[model samples]
Every structure is written in C-alpha cells, then in structure tokens.
Target: MVKKLHKEGSLEPQIEDMINRINELQQAKKKSSEEMVEAQALWESLHRELDSLNGEKVHLEEVLSKKQEALGILQLHCQRKEGGAQRKNVLQECTEQISVHNCQVTESCRQRKLGVQVEEQLENLMSQHKDLWELHMLKQRLTWEIRALQSSKEQLLTEEKLARDKLLEVERRLRSPPEVGGARMVNDGRRRWRYSRGRRLPQTVAPQRTRPAKERPAPSAPAPAARTWSRPQTHRTRPAPSPTPLLRRRPEIKARISDRPPPPASVCSPIPNCFTNRS
Candidate 1:
C-alpha cells in the first residue's frame, strides 16, 4: 500500500503539470485574440481619419474657388462705381453753373419788364442774351460730354464682360480634376520631397516603343565575339592608311502625267501631275 501511494503521488504531480500547461496555452490564445481585435480597431480608426481628411480637402478646394470668383466680381464692381462717381461730379458742377446763369437771366427780365431806364434795360437785355448764348453753348458741350461718358461706359461694360469670361475660364480650370491637367497624385510625405526637389513632373508620357514579333531577332542566338588585332612585334613601322570617304547616291526623279488635258492659260498655272494617267 505504501508503494501504491508513492506511484499515486508521482501521477498526481504529472497530471497537475499537464493541466498547468493547458491553462497557459488557453491564456496565450485569449491574449492573441485580444491583440487582433485591438489591431483591427486601430486600422479602422486610421481609415476613418483618411476619409475625413479627403473630405476636408475637397471642401477647402471648393471654398477657395468661390473666394477667387467673388474677388474678381468685386473688383469689377468697384471699378464701375469709381467711373460713375467721376461722371456724377462732372454733372453736379454743370448743374451748379446752369443754376447761376438762370438766376442772372431772371433778374434781367424782371428789371426790363418794370420799365426803368430804357438804355439800362437794353444793356441788361444784351447781357442776358449773351448769357443765353453761353448757356446754349454749355448745353451743347454737356450733351457731347454725356455722349462720351456713355461711350466710355459701354466700353467698360465690354471690358467687364471679357474679364468675367476670363475669370470663368480660370474657375473652370480650378474646378477640373487635377489628373486632367497631368498633375500627379502625391502622398503627404512625398509632397515634401517633391517641393524640396523643385522639379516639375513630365506632362505627358511618350508612347512605348515596341518591336513586332516578326521584326524582333531571336534572343537565343549567341552574340558575336569582339574582334582583336595583333600588333607588330617590331618597332614603329609604316603608318596606317586613311579611311576612304563615303559617297551617297542621289535619288532619281520621275515625271508624272495627268489623265485630263490642262485648261487654257490663265494668270496662274495648273498644278502639276495632280491625277494619275491610266491610259
């Protein structure tokens, strides 16, 4: 019975050790699952941040475009207002002068109707007539001035229209996708590198050169060996002969005939060999 108890004691420790090992494995598995969940959550947060940043970028671009358009319109309006103010000042000055001339004419007419001295009345009437003539001349000048101002206003309106068109063009360009302008999509880190390099990217890619299957030489063929020349063992002998000059042959020219007879001579001659003669 003592021996049996010894065996049982040994088995007990072994079973306990096995249970401890299983518990450790279970705990490790649980920790691994928890870490995986944490990693997934971090990735999702990063994705959300990226999406938010993209949206903000789009909003900022729209706002900037609108601001530029508004500034252009405001500038045009300010210029128009300045021109109108100048015209208004000229009109106000003319109005004041006309008012003074009317007052003088009224006083002269009143004195003449009251039958005071005829000579004095005649002189006053003459002065009034002179003032009337001046007023008539002033009216003609004012009419011409108004016409000129109208023309200037028309010209300014045309210029404003052109400016608006140009601004619209600029805004359209801004609104267009950057890819359409051959601009490259850059990552946040890469943009800094590009700025530091100060190099503009290529606007268009050249078409790739391709060799037709029939035109391509077989690659399995071995390359030719380089040529070697043996030098003379003796001291410097005769010098080498000079290279012969290469001569190019000139291309031959052919005369072409037309199928129809040429028209009668005119100021200009008919084009030569326009049609092929089949006969």
Candidate 2:
C-alpha cells in the first residue's frame, strides 16, 4: 500500500522517518568497542602480582634448612663430654689393683728367707749329736782295759808266795841230821855239804878199814857205781800259758754338709683385653 502511495507522489512523510532509524544503529556499535579495550588491560595487571609471590616462598625454605643443621652439631658435642668422664674412672681402678699385687709379692719373698735359715740350724744340731755318741763309746772301752790289767797283777802275786813256802820246808829238813851209826852218818853230812857247794867228791875218800887181802874188790869194778851216785837232779820244769789277743782300733770318720740351691721362680702375665678392644 505504501509503494502504491509513493508512486502516486502522496508518500513524503514515510521517507523522512526511515532516514532517522539508520543513524541510531551506527552510534550503538561505536560504544561496545570502547568497553572491550578496558577489560584486556585489567587481566595483564593480575599476572604480574602472581610471579612476585612465588620468589618470596623459595627464600623462606632455604632459611629453614640452615637452622636444622646448627641444632645437630650442638647435640654431638654434649655426648663427647660424658664419654671422657667414664674413661677417667676406669684408669683409677687399674692403679689400685697394681698396688695390691706389689704387697703380696713382698710378703712371699720374706717367708722364703725364713725357711732357709731354719733348715741350716737343724743340720748343725744333727752333726753335734753324732759327735757326742762317739765320745761316749770310747770312754766305755778304756774302762774295760783298766780292769783286765788289775786282774793279771793279782794272779802273779799268788804264784810268788807259793814258791817261797816250798823253799823254807827243804831247809828245815836238812838242819836235823839222821843217826845212821857212827861213821856213815858223818859221811852223809859231808856229802850234802859238798852238793850245796857245787863240787863232786872222789869215791876213795871214806876212812880205810883193816880188811884181809881176799875181801877187797878190783878198783875198776867200783869206779862205775861211784859215778852214778855223784851227780843229783835239782831243777823242775813248768808249762807256759797261751798269750791273749790284742783289741781292734776304731776307724776315723769325716762329715760333710752340703747346701741346696734355691728353686726357680715362675711368673705369669695376663692379656690386656681393654686395650685391644679399644683399637
């Protein structure tokens, strides 16, 4: 209907109204482009703030690691101090034990010396006892010898007295002459006197008798009878006694004393485990 009106030249009012609506659309497009440019500038500012916060976190982590290392070094120094005290106590105990051992060794040496002295005294006493016993035996032997000599002297005295009594009896008998006739008794006395003087008498010394010529014997026959009666035996024989044996003498003895050597000493040393284990 509007196209029919324009062709007939009755449409001037409708054409002016179309040209005003086209100008209003152009102004709204220009205002939307200006708002998009402002939003892009705000996004760039937020990205720079996030990068600065990351650098500050890294620096804080390095500081924490250094503080932990310093605490560990302090703990190690405290443990070393406690170990030194324990070592000093062990050294003191070792010194005390060594002193006790030294005292025991000194006592043992003194006892050994005393025992040696006692043994020497006992040996001397035994030797003295043996000497005394030998002297007593010698005294007894001398006493026996003296008694034997006294008994022999007494026996000799008795034998001498018996010989003297026999001699006196023979002298008394000769003093009283026998009466055997006149001339015969006188002749016997003269013969005894001649025998005492150690002289032999002749056969013809008797007084001559007055005999006839035929009664006298031949001189040669009477000579043998006279010789047999002239000599008389006087001495007697006695048997000899057997001799006594001599006594034996004792042998000499020598004594010797010998000393014994001291025994060897033994020593033992213990291994030190404490020093080896420490290494």
Candidate 3:
C-alpha cells in the first residue's frame, strides 16, 4: 500500500495521504516484528516444554516396565500356586483310597501290620493337609495382589496413552504459528524495503539537516574543524536528530524491530493446559 503512493505528488492531500500510508506501514512492521519476537519466545518455551514432556514420558515408561516386571513375578507365583493345588488334589485322592481299604484287614498279624500302616498314612495325611491349607491361604493372597497389579498396570497404560496424545497436540501447536509469523515478516519486510528505497532523501538534504548541528557548535570541541567535519559525517549519519522529537522517535520505532533475546527464566502467558487440566 505504501509503495503505490506518489511521494513526488504536486498537491498537499496527496502528500498527506502518502505520509499517512508510510506511518501505517511502519506501524504495521513494528507490530509484525513484535509478534515475531513473541512467537519466537513462545517457540522456545514450547520446545522446553516438549523436552520436559519427553522426560516425563521416559519416566513413566520406566515405571510401567517395573510394574510389568512385578506382574510377571506375580504370574509365576500364581502358576506355582495352581501346580501345588493340583498336587494337593492328587494326594487327597490317594488318602481317600487308603481309608476305603482300611476295613479289608481282619486277622491278628495282618491287622497289626495294617494298623501300623494306617497310623503312618494318617500322620502323612495330617502334614499334607496342613501344607495344603497354607498353600490355599497363600494362593488367595497372591490372587488379590495380582488383581491389584493388573488394575494398576492398566491405569498406567491409560495415562501413558493420554500423555502421548497430549505431546502430539502440543507439538502441533508448536509447529503452526511460526509459519504465519514468517510469512507476515517476509511481506512486511518487502513493503518496508520498497517504501524506504523509493523515499530515500538526496545528498542535498544532508546540509540542511546538518545546519542545525552547526548552530550547536559549543559541543563541537574543535569549532573550526566542525565546518569541514559536517560534509563526510552528515551523509554517513543519515539519522541525525531532527528539530522535532517526533522525528527522533522514528528511529526508536525502528529499534523496536530488533529481536529481543528471550530470557531463560521468562515466564510467559499461560498456554492452555490440555495435558494437566483436562476436563
């Protein structure tokens, strides 16, 4: 818009409009540069956030692996419990058979041998029953523990999945805005270059601008050299302070375009916390 304006116009309205357009373009450039700076700061913050999330992910994975190892150990215990229960059932069947045959022995010597055999078998059965009872109690406890770990593992898996989703979402947010800022800066840069190039003042304007410097000659320690000094220096320092402070402010506006290095501890505006504050 600023480029299309005729700065060499013959009328006052045209000149006024051109100046207005130039100011508007510069203001827009300033705004875009500020946005670019903010976006860059945000980009770095998001990267740091990404690193934090990655570390969290790794930590969670380690915890999950540990849980899995625990689950595996419980599974092994459960298997052993099952095997012991099966062995207990076989021993119980053998005891039942022995009891069923006890009545068949009737004679004196035979009865004595059967009686001794039955006493030994009863002792063995009592010991076996005690062991079976303990095993049953242990099995019950193990089952309860296994169920708890299974439930916990499932919960951990769910949390991991959610974290993964949140990471992706955050990364997506990180990628999008820089493209917009870059395009905005490119277009604004081009407009600023064209406008400045077209409106560059001629060498003749330098002496007029420098004439004010000559008036303030007390600061020019070598007052005699100041006359000869104005020629080379005036052209070089195109941004010589003008009569109006408004003209001085224009350079400040340009300075505002310079990128601000983001502080490491800079606490920015709160990003929407989808990861932690999810409804």
lDDT of each: 0.52, 0.42, 0.53
TM-score, per-candidate, Cα-based:
0.27, 0.27, 0.33
lDDT of 1 by residue, 82-137 (tens): 88998898889889888988888888887776656777788899988877766665
lDDT string, candidate 3, 1-91, tens digits: 3344444445667778878998999999999999999999999999999999999999999999999999999999999999899889988
Between 2 and 3, whose TM-score is larger?
A: 3
lDDT of 2: 0.42
Distance from true location, Cα of 271 in model 2, Å: 69
> On lDDT, who's better, 1 or 2?
1
Clashes of 2: 0
**Of models 1 and 3, which has the larger lDDT?**
3
Over the stretch 1-279, how does candidate 2's per-residue lDDT look in tens digits?
Answer: 688867888676655655565555555555555555555555555555555555666665666666666666666665666566667667767767777777777777777677777777777777666555544444443344334334433433443344345334534544444222221133321223212111222222342233454644556543322211223323233222222111010011001001212121221122232212311
RMSD of each: 67.0, 24.7, 80.8
